[model samples]
Target: MSIEIPGYRSGTWVLDPAHSEVTFSVRHMMISKVRGTFGVKEATLIAPENPLEAKVEAKVDVSSIDTKDEGRDAHLRSADFFDVENHPVMTFTSTGTRVQNGDFLVDGDLTIRGITKPVTFEFDFGGFGKDPQGNYKAGASATAVIDREEFGLTWNAALETGGVLVGKEVTIGLDLQGALQV
Candidate 1:
């Protein structure tokens, strides 16, 4: 089967920061999950007539992490996690795209804390349409799970019970809205 978008066109699409969000979730306290959002500094999609041929590049501000807890957020920004002072930005660059079992997948390199690793994100296209301002827009969401330790984020506390305080797996998600450059 071939990938198809209802109104796909070739052009540059700039991410609408106000309508886009970068979120993440990680297992906390070996029982529950903690979620947060990051501020997107910038992102662009170089689209092609064939959606699978498109390329994407994005940058996220590491210091914008908000887990609803100031103290925990501060710790995440420190050397134990993101180390914002040294690595203020995390980035993703698409390398390729493919489809499997009727699902679209985007293969890319995700860099965090100065470490780069290949990751694949399952993508779901939310279709295309024109906004009230008459600008063409596209929407999509993608998600991927990664081992924090693979990115050098090995900080954790031993629990009195058995497991660690923080889970090693982290789920990263992106809800994006982009306007086609006219």
Candidate 2:
């Protein structure tokens, strides 16, 4: 199932931390939204000769979660949420890729707080570019939605207005810029 990633030559690539990010957002107080980013620890993307068979493995530091408030960040790193001391990292590994509606769909397993579940990311290949230093680069974006409770992140408060303090569903977005290493 070979599908072309436009402008990208088939090979392995490494995500450039300076240009890549993974962020997530969740509804807060049933009205507003809170967003945070998890720092990328490392990643390797194997763009196979048959691109559809590509594989990507990544780890994100849960302890690096930041929402601008140190208090909240501490709570997220505590036992109530991510429990970064026990589970310091969240990980993703793609199982396969398929095209639908002219877009690439990556089926993968997302693990958080020791819970592993199958999820899909809407993948977009951003083609190729050359850095000033002459290094070839390829970019892509991926987005997915998941249930926080499913991953054991169920802490919340009930509002007198009738809704919970935090929504159960979370949206995760990944913008990756990979430098071709081979």
For candidate 2, the lDDT comes to 0.91
Task: Give one digit per residue, the lDDT tens place, for model 2 in 48-123.
Answer: 6777888989999999999999999999999999999999999999998899889889999999999999999998
Query: lDDT tens string, model 1, 34-128?
Result: 99999999999998878788899999999999999999999999999999999999999999988999889999999999999999999888989
Off by over 4 Å in 2: none
Which residue pairs of candidate 2 clash?
A: none
lDDT of each: 0.94, 0.91
Note the residue pairs that clash in candidate 1. none
Full-model lDDT, candidate 1: 0.94
